[model samples]
Target: MRNLKYYFAIFSIFIMISCGENAEKKVEEKSKEETQIETEAKVSEKNVILFFGNSLTAGMGLEASEAFPVLIQNRLDSLNYNYEVVNAGLSGETTASGKNRINWVLNQDVDVFVLELGANDGLRGIPIAETRKNLQDIISTVKEKNPNTKIVLAGMQIPPNMGEEYTTDFRNIFPELAEENNVELIPFLLEGVAGDPELNQQDGIHPTAEGYEIVADNVWSVLEDVVEKE
Candidate 1:
């Protein structure tokens, strides 16, 4: 009877030890799961900067890495800014197409929206009023989707092939919209790079890799202020 009692006591201790270990293991698992959830939330919390535009934004005739938007991303990362850049640039996107597609792109939360459309419209000699309306509509949609979204318009100018009157009106559209909508404006997206053969690709429109560096600078000038404010 004494031997049986001693064995029973030992069995109880063993069961207790096993249960304690199991409880500790479950606690450790829960801690790990909580840590994973927090890490995922941090990643998802990163702000998004969407570049919406045409081939210039798309880096036409150049590698995607060579595009100005990616260069901007590199700069942001180097500066330790926690922003993700979404290059929504389609090669042939005009203001009308951009207006049509703005809703789809707005499905994701956008912290900063850099508008780069209307260049194609300018080049195509699309009616200035029509381009202006399309651009305004796009801006309106963005504002409606999220009033908190900071907008930045990339001003562009085309050759006089479209006629000086039309070209001037097209150029005026950007600032007018910027003032009216109270959004940031990149005075000239290709400032130093435009009209320079050395900076242009063989097609004489898109920027070369080296040219894109300057273009990135132009964007960064305005974008830096907006980002810092944010």
Candidate 2:
């Protein structure tokens, strides 16, 4: 009877050891999976980027996929990010028009704002002071809605034909606005593609597909910082 009891004790101890080892293995696997999921989520950019601008932003002359906003979307996708870019661009919209669109244009999911208005204002030769004020109001409204939202101010420069003084004033609007709003600014929205006639479409104002690629590069350079993957 004593011998039999000893054997039973040994068998029970062995079973307990096996059960503990299995439990430990399961816990380790679950931990590893959790870490992988977290890493992947961080690597994929899932933030919403709302682009508000004029004809250039609306892809006025280019196809749907040829627009800068669309190109940005493609680039983000290639990086395995989960994000959405809204082209809230109205052709020929001045700074005032952008102000009116602000309150309603903000979506709940907006994590970043790319302000590209004022180009039409420059074209129309509107007062720079009013343009600055209008842009300021839009940024303020957005900040009020989402204090943490990252902003990219898309700058514009009128042609020298607009008059040197006027062109300089128009160009300065972006930096001044950015300083006041405390946001990132792209030196030029059209950068390399604006004056290049070959890259422009028939209107010579809006960019063609090739031109939009350059525009996308300009925006992406500054926006790449706050832009994160899901």
Candidate 3:
């Protein structure tokens, strides 16, 4: 009977060890799952603000960090806002090009979309009707992708050298589109910097770093309200 007791005790000890090992494994798995959840939550918490546009927005002839979108990122950081700014501006990108690739850009979630395209179209004297249609399509696609996304139209105007009537029509496109689409509009992306030679680079087209600061202010004026609404 003593021998029998010893065997039973050994069996009991084995069962207890097996149970302890399983519990430890379960604990490790739970920890790993919790860590994954936390990582995903952090990623989801950051709102994406996409600055989609042309050379001016691309900060041509200047450092990328000096771009208005990067300036906006710095401002957001200073304000402690949970947002990530993506400067998707391509040099010499026209409205047509913007429309063609907008779908790929929309692949990611966008909380705020700042539209700065069409300047090249105006400079190249592309038909206003075509530019308008492209802009409309771009906005429509963005809404279709993420209806909750807020759009901010950055108004741009071509030089009067483009011609009086064409310039007027181009300038009107922004506010008209904003009114129709019910989106926010920045009156002119280069409000305080456009005509000032000091604010412009050698090409007198793109803004200098000092000029982008004012551009940042122009965008921030409208963007702050949209961000605060959330």
Best by lDDT: 1
Q: Return the TM-score for candidate 1, rounded to 2 decimals.
A: 0.87
lDDT of 1 by residue, 115-225 (tens): 999888988889999999999999999999999999999999888998889989999999999999999999999998888999999889999999999999999999998
Pairs with backbone N, CA or C atoms under 3 Å apart (clashes), candidate 1: none
In order of appearance, the predictions have TM-scores of: 0.87, 0.79, 0.84
How badly does each model clash, as a count of residue pairs? 0, 8, 0
lDDT of each: 0.89, 0.83, 0.88
Report the C-alpha lDDT of model 3 over 1-230, residue by residue, as the tens digit. Answer: 21343454455555555666657776566556555655555544678899999998889999989999999999998898889899999998999999999999998889999999988999899999999999999999999999999999999988988789999999999999999999999999999998899999988888999999999999999999988422
- Model 2 alpha-carbon drift over 4 Å, by segment: 1-45
Task: Give lDDT tens digits, candidate 2, residues 86-117.
Answer: 88888888889889878889855588999999
List the pairs of residues colliding in candidate 3. Answer: none
CA RMSD, predictions in order = 11.5, 12.2, 11.3
